[model samples]
Target: MSPAFRLGGLELQRFARARLTRAALVAVVLIPLLYSGLYLWSFWNPQGNIGNIPVALVVLDDGDLGRELADNLIDRQIFAWKETDPADAEKGVQEGTYYGSLTIPADFTANLKSPSKDGPPQPAYLQVHVDQGKSYLFETIAKAVFAEVQATVGKSAISDYLDRIFVSFGKLHDSTLKAARGADQLADGAGDARSGAGRLQDGLGTARQGTAKLSDGLRTAGTGASTLAQGLGSAKKGADDLLSGAYKLHRGAGTLTQGLVTAKDGTSKLAAGAVKLDQGAAKLAAGNAEAFQQVDRFRPVINQLADQAVPFLRSHTGDIRQLAEFVNVAASFLADCLADLPARIQADRVKADKAYKALKTYLDTHPDLDPQLRTLLEAAEKAAKRLAELADWLDALVGEHLADLKQLERDALGVARLARQLANLAPRLAGLIDQARDKFNELDNGLAKLADGAAKLHQGTGEAVKGATKLDAGMTKLVDGASKLDTGLGALVAGANKLDIGLGKLTGGANKLNAGLGQLGQGAGSLDSG
Candidate 1:
């Protein structure tokens, strides 16, 4: 315990001595201070875009457009680009040797001509190498430089390829618009066509029904025509019978006219003969006047003799009685005949007067003919008076048989007049037959015209039915076209929706790029602060 106490005192004394004598603590403080001073001296004076900037241009592929793009970045004064070999270009970017580098694949020109292919595989590409976090001095400077480089290289590719894409897109847009408009138009037109077709179909159905009705009507008309033909046939038969009867009647009328002419000639001859007889009787009476006066004186003398003979013959009768008696008987018989003749003549006169009175009574009762009938009646009455005188004389002279025969002659003359009137009636009936035949012919011609008109109506109905069927077929085709137009319009709307989504994604990508650029600038700031 005594030795440990003595050693602790000595060790305390040595540690105190070493703290004053070591010298290495001063060296650690001064070295750190020197290094901090050197870093602050070189980095604290920050150079903006103008003083000094380092840029790396590593062209990894063989293309003039890539080299030109790097040169273009330099011309804008955004970076100081340095070209490195392609083999080292990517390695240099990763090791922080240069800011970035661009590489172009072969066939870049050919790929620019057309972007899409349906047949073959295509190979054309571009490569850009960049460090994730590099010095802000180079990275910040190269940002606008590399963007310009990208744009210049893209322009160097086949310009027609971009044009083709643009033109095709434009065509697609126009086609899509056309399809939309066409769909609307087709839908409207199809609807109208469908409605029209329905109406036309209904009209065609009605027309078919009407055709059926027309056929029925035609059948009925045919039946009516047949019946009318039968009626006309019967009428022709009846006409034949009537014509035969009329011909017979005409012949009878001709015979009657000839009979009337013969009768009139005989009556005229009889009248002339009666007038000559009357004149001869007048002349004989006038010329025999002296003889007639002598005869009158002789008649008195004869009457005296007859009286004288009557008395003398009665007294001297015995021998002369036989001869005188025969003479007396003959004279008495002659006197009896003379007395009965005068009485018979008186009765004939009375009968003639009664006939005239009856005829006058009949004429007065039937006097529809005025003054003309009166003139004819007066002439007839004078002729009748003469006939009555003649009848009286004849009745006194002729026997009863001859008087009855003369009365029959008057009845026969009346029968001839009645026959003449009947003959005239037959000619009038023949004229009626001619008029009836003409009327029947007109009826037959009118029925023929009606039959022709019905045939024309049937032909017109058939044409109308065929035209309606064609119209219905055309309208159905228009309705089908609308569906194709609607499908095209839907695809156009989908393309426009994709374009909007891409634009939104592009905006988000641009915001992320801005943040990355800020981080690179922060890493570069460490060269001064750290």
Candidate 2:
């Protein structure tokens, strides 16, 4: 250290003794300081001077997108933006009046819009026209600035397109939610429909059973009606026979009445002869004892004839009384038949009508019934209508003849009383010939009235036979119709079951659709949020 210190002090003394050396040393130090300071000052804050650089802006676009970009660049003041035409901008750049020219083409907005359309995408450009011969540094700076402008325009266009896409996603999310709600309602409705279809199937099954039973009952009723018709026919024949017998009895009673009147006249003549004979007997009492004995012998023979006649008249009276009683019974039966037949027929008619209505309702509701079934239902309805008409006819017949039937009953009772009076007088006919004649005349009148009543009863019975036959036929048709209804109901129930199954499947599908739509809505909501 001591030797270095000594050498440095000797150099300093030599420097102080020479003016040229001192001046050269000072100049060397100042030259370095000046160069360093000048270089530092020139580079300091170069970005602040960028506003002094001239840049030409040429906007030839037909839309506002290009103008918007130009306005943004001007407001930023990244460079001294000069608004000019395409020709002027080009001339300014070549003459170094502008560091560079930024040109927005006529198709700039069109190209930006193209990206949002449904065709091939196009790229939007910000054209940079720079002159390297004017100044390399300026050209470089202009290119860099134009590159930033391109980024700014690209970001603006991209951001606008992205914003529109996000808005569309938001709308889609709302629409999807509405669709999902609708699908849920549809699913619920399908489920309810499926349940209703099941209930319908059950109800159809019940109807089928009821119809089957009804068919069986109708068949049984048809058979019973046929039997009843046969009985009515036989009753009608009996009534006709009774009418013929009553006519014969009326003629016989008239003949008997005339004979009794002649007998009564002879009895009166005999009584007068007896009176004259009594006067002659007083005169010849003493001398004619032999004549008396002859009279006594003829009296016994007359008495024997009276005895025989009395017994015969009594037997005939008993036969006539029995015939009158039979007539009374027939008349009473006819009155009862007329009184009750109409109500019974009406009740049956009502039943038939009800059955027809039920079947018709089912047929109308189920239009898709089998052809054969429909035909059967139509036949049943016709049969029911015919039955009702037959009932009306029978009821009217009985009602029209009701008074006649009651009169016949009264006439039959009168004939029975006449026969009873004749029977009481038969034992005393010889003593009471006049009274017996009167009774015979009354019996003849009663018999004639009974014969007229018999004729009416016979006619009414014939009508009953015809009505019974029609009822039998109508019941047979009803039975057939009921069978057809049962079959149709079976088919309907089967179809209902199928419908229920189909509705179940539809419900499942609707539920799945609702669930999928819910997921889609959720995804759309997420996209919109992003």
Candidate 3:
């Protein structure tokens, strides 16, 4: 330290003796102070001077969000923010007119609005264009400023999106409350409906029971209708037989009337013959008396005459007896014919009337009977009435004339007995002959009256045949109608069975619907609680 100090003093004595060297030493010392002071002065308020840094702001977005971001950067004086297009901002950064440029893309606002929850998030970008070739500090400062701008945009966009999300949550909460209230009401309605469905199912069960009874009743009615149809068929057969009998009776009455007419003519001729015989008998008796008085003169002649006359008288008496027997037989035949004819007709009339009444009653009970069937019934009724009237007429006629027919038979027998007595007694012959002639005339009158009555009866019987024929056709139609009614009842029973089956299926569906509604109500209750 002593030698070094002695050498530094010699150098300082030399620098003191030279003016140039002294001046050089002072300059070197001042150069360090000046350089240090200038450096310190340059870095003193760099942050404060940040506003002087030229930067470009390019807002290409179509929405207000981009413009609002640009305006905020300018107001904050974070950089020398300039409103410019993308080309101008790029040109300014390259020409050193701007340190860097910040660009908001055309889709910035749109991209920010598209949340990740909606779909894939599209990130909004703020692009920074800096010229690091011009100055590294400028690139660094631009990057820092862009970072701040990014944070401001993120904060604003995120806050707005979060506000929107909160509002949506509020709306969702209100909608959930309304839905819960509606679900509660629906549950109540479903409960009421379930009860109603139960009641409906019970009612349907009752209806099914009633329908079963109805079907059974219809089946019973169908059986009864079948029986009725069978009865009608039998009735038709009876009617056909009645018509046949009426035709036969009509033909028989016509034959009997003609026979009575022939007998009446024969009786008149026999009466004339009997009168002539009586006159002859009186003459012969008178002649015999005279002959006896002259017997002595003409005894041989008297004997010859007496033998011929006796033979002739015997032959005439035999012929007269045969004629009287014929008259008695004819009267008996007439009496037998009238005896039961009225009774038979009366019985048939009653039967026909009964059948007609039954048809009418059936028609009255069944108002919906086919029109054609009704017409047939009406025709049958008319025919029955005609038959009844004819029966009544015959009954009245027989009642009025039956006694006269019996008296005619007795008188004919009496005439036959008188004729037999006349053959033995010639003296009584004339008186008996007069009585026989008178009886024959009375018998002839009775036979003529009977023939007239017989003609009327034949006419009445012909009409009865027509009426009976009509009744037969009508009964056949009635049988067919009854069969149709039975068939219709069977169809109705089948339809009722189908309806009962349908109701059972409907009840099952209602039960399923009630269970589904119960599940829906429970789910809604959980949602409301949440």
How well is each residue in 1-530 modelled by candidate 2, as lDDT tens digits? 69999987786686667664566455545554554554455356656687888989889888888888888788778789999997798557545588667777665676567432212233344556555443324434744575557555556644463322110000001233334455555545654543344344356556556655655555555555555545544554554345335433433443344444455455555555555554444444433444444444555455566667666655676565566567556655665665566678778768877877887788889999899989998898788778777777776876788787567656755655665565555455545644454455555555555555555555555555555555555554554554444344434433433343233223323333444445554554443343
How do all models score by TM-score?
A: 0.21, 0.23, 0.25
lDDT (Cα, 0-100) at 499 in candidate 1: 41
Candidate 2's displacement at residue 103, Å, is 0.2
Q: lDDT winner among the candidates? A: 2
Better of 1 and 3 by TM-score: 3
Give the Cα lDDT of each candidate.
0.46, 0.56, 0.55
Candidate 1: the clashing residue pairs are none
Q: Could you give the candidate ranking by TM-score, starting with the highest?
A: 3, 2, 1
- lDDT per residue as tens, model 1, 408-519: 4444444444444444433343344445444544544444444444444444444544444444343333333332333333333234323422332232233334454445
Report the lDDT tens digits of candidate 3 across residue range 201-299.
346456656655655555555555555545554554554345335433433443344444455455555555555554555555455444444543444
Flag regions of model 1 displaced more than 4 Å.
Answer: 1-54, 60-64, 74-77, 90-100, 104-113, 116-530
Instruction: Report clash pairs, candidate 2.
Output: none
Question: How many angstroms is residue 261 displaced in model 1 relative to the true structure, after the best TM-score fit?
Answer: 99
